[model samples]
Target: MPKTTPTPGVVITRSTLHKAQELAALSYGSVWTGPSGEESSGEAVARHLEATAALLATNGWDRIWTPPTPAQLAEADAAATTETMLRQLLDYIREEERSASGRLTAGDALNRVARTADGDPDTGRIAGDVLDLVVVALTGHPSARFGYWSERLNRTFADITALLTAGALFARTYGPAPERAA
Candidate 1:
């Protein structure tokens, strides 16, 4: 793509780009801390944990059994026999804006810029240049995947991503996994 220069003052920082990348890692490992400083495990995770513990306690660590429900059996079968849900999901997101992945407006290009660039700056001509380039590059693409976003949205996603990332990193670094927390 040809270079795009933003109208003088529109700046998109590298940190902005980094934030976008982090938001896109939503499915990484089922581990993150929430804002309340509790285990990231909420109802969904708790159910999984409870089910697993019941299964282990009922049977034993060495035992394995078929999933109890037809729905579960279907899910298991789909694991190998079906097209990954990602393709269907991406299509659904594009058509209906009804998926979690659609929550991201432009993380991919932002991540590309952040990863390809180095030594992110806090302030100066280079910072301005990088941000301006980000705006231009993002806007250059059509309203397809990873396209333009308002700076505020980009910054917000970046911050959320940063928090989730820090939560995950600190949890792993400073404490045991939730099962071991007991």
Candidate 2:
């Protein structure tokens, strides 16, 4: 008989399985920390199992298990797979908005002008030209006002993309750094 190949999108690979196990172990340790660690094992394991089941279901493996009722498996199947890219994009936008609002609040006249202008006075004529390009790209219009706002949004989006790219590069270069205290 020919060697059987794994069906596409059916079974989780060994590496994925190992990563899941590592995540589960980390989650278990975090949950079971503190003075009552002994008391939290059962609850932690239950949570871990639920998470594992949801992960499996999302990856289309819920049908492989025999004991769980169809209804239970169906509920797991409905669990959402993570959308990290969308989440990261939204987070970057929020951060940009916060930074913009902060600059505006500080009464920085130069920043205010730079933020709204068609072109930067200090940064050469490229700022205005870039804004014009963005406006045309965004609205398909030749109007100055549309171009101005479109430029603002485009600049903001570009800044955000750059920040996220830099952040990822830094994270990759440094590995996972210790989290800062709140």
Candidate 3:
């Protein structure tokens, strides 16, 4: 008979497994050892299973995992564009409507603008430009308004994209793996 290939899995050392298990258990609150190191909480085997992914990650098992492709990076850039625009627009609108009465009206308008922009980057850009007019009308201070826009723009969308992309990749890559046989 042909030798069967072992079922695919990360080969981690026993110590790494122990440490990862401990950290994972702590994070999930499954086996919470009290501050005194005396008391402990109930164990949920199901929740404990949720910890396996983190175990794999911490063990250097995923070093061979594929890096983000160019297409994915481009997608992140597009998403970042829309996200950054929406955040800046929201902040600027809030800044322009500082008074209580204006805030009430601004709240409604802000919701409408958000709905209108939805996920489209172009619509976000347009909404932001229109909101800029409102800000200019509300606050006639040219220097202050320019300063705010400058600061907002300085927060590069690429940074936001990179952070979000990394988080998403981690979540996707670190899902629970099959249990080790006893």
lDDT by candidate, in order shown: 0.32, 0.29, 0.29
What ranges in model 1 sit over 4 Å off?
1-101, 104-154, 178-182
Q: What is the C-alpha RMSD of each candidate to the true structure, in Å?
A: 20.3, 27.5, 25.0
Collision pairs in model 1? 12-131
Instruction: Estimate, for each residue in 1-182, the C-alpha lDDT of model 2 and write its tens digit.
Output: 32233222222233433333343344334322233322222222222223322333343221111332222112223345557555655676666555432211111221233333221232112222222323233233344322234223223423322222322232222222223200
TM-score of 2: 0.19
lDDT: which candidate is best? 1
lDDT by residue (1-182, candidate 3, tens digit) is: 32223222222233433433433344433222222333221121112212322232233222112333222111234546777867766765665444223211221222333333221222222223322322233233322221243124232323222222222222223322223110
Per-prediction TM-score, please?
A: 0.19, 0.19, 0.18
Worst 10 residues of 1 by lDDT: 119-128
Weakest 10 consecutive residues of candidate 2 by summed lDDT: 101-110
Which residue pairs show backbone clashes in model 3? Answer: none
- Displacement of residue 35 (Cα, Å) in model 1 is 15
Question: Which stretches of candidate 3 lie above 4 Å from their native place?
Answer: 1-154, 177-182
lDDT of 1 by residue, 2-119 (tens): 3344343334444534443343233243233332334432222232223323333343332112232221112333554346566565565555433222222222222322332221
As a whole number from 0 to 100, the lDDT of residue 72 in candidate 3 is 13
Please provide the root mean square deviation of candidate 3 (C-alpha atoms, Å): 25.0
